[model samples]
Target: GKFPEISLDDYECVMAQVERQYNIRCYNLYRTYRTTKVRPIHVAPEDWQWLIDNLWSDEQFQKRSKQNSINKSKQEMKSLVGTINIETYEVTLVRNPETGAWPSAVDVWRAIYMKANGTWSIPNGAEILNNLEEAAETHKERIAAAPIPLAEHFALVLGRKPNHSRGVGIGAVNQGAQERYRIRARAEAADQRASDAQNQAAALLEEVERLT
Candidate 1:
């Protein structure tokens, strides 16, 4: 099919007809060109070329950046591992002179350290043995003559209770003292009641004599 070419006058007339039908204004075709105050659209060839080059280089930079980040993470992990790798020492179990039994230096040391660390339970054998050996060395004399009751020896020497529950001599003494105190209190109370009764009986006898 052959298409018809319309002249500028015919095109303008058609636009005017459409605008009139639609109740809108059409662009003027006969305006003269002038240097008006307006913002100009500027394009920089250098910047555009730079952006194109950068877009191409971005893949390499991103790959290197990702590798660097992974390397940094690996280095941090290695540092952490180095910090956590602690050396453990060997400890021996020696006979406690006071208790007359084998006392593990590791157990004692571990107990002390655990206590310091706010833990009540016994620590691993290695740590316990290490601490006990240290303690035994510090107090050699006390360890030599192992006392029958380890706890009592500790109390006597240290002026307080020992962590190990052995030979608590004061428990019976404390219980006896409490019983004696209770008995004394009861006796005092009974004496007071008996004295009051006697006083009442004497007053009753005096009243009877006066009436007679």
Candidate 2:
């Protein structure tokens, strides 16, 4: 699409819009990158190999219910594998051999310059717009490659029991492990809540300072 005449003010407007959509400090797309690496059970859903290797342990579920546990583990493994779909959230550009770069930004500047100088020809404007369109397609491909979030990925790991070693042993051991997992889960949740509260307080302080 051909852009209307772009003044210097228009260029600044465009820059501000870009900054709003990105974090200038990080040099990474604010909306596209993972802001936090921490996970509920320290498992990254995107780490397919790690999730496959550790999500289910055969030894932990052995006993009278050994076969049942094994079957469940297999099913859980299958489910986890299927659940890990990558997310793609942004555009990427293939570099031009002549210029060693995608021409989207350059095209924008050229278009703005041409408009400013009153030398904006339709043919040149069309080429710039075409470059931007092609670059956008590449970015879409990159966005599609991103992995989706794994919500409560470790939830399946808790309360998983191994059969008692003896033919008639008490269930105390499995119960203890389950209890510990439950307690730790609660503790982690509390910690997350505290951290969230602190963040909110800090944001509020910044807002107050801005107003002052």
How does each model score on lDDT?
0.41, 0.38
The digit string of per-residue lDDT tens for model 1 on 92-127 reads 333467984543433433433344545533234344
**Candidate 2 lDDT, tens digit per residue, 85-122?**
11110022233679654333334324333455555443
Relative to the unseen true structure, what is the C-alpha lDDT of residue 157 in candidate 1, on a scale of 0 to 100? Answer: 36
Error of 1 at 63 (Å): 79
lDDT of 2: 0.38
Best by lDDT: 1
| Candidate 1 residue-wise lDDT at 41 | 35
Residue 163, candidate 1: Cα error in Å is: 13
Off by over 4 Å in 2: 1-173
Q: In model 2, how many backbone clashes occur?
A: 12
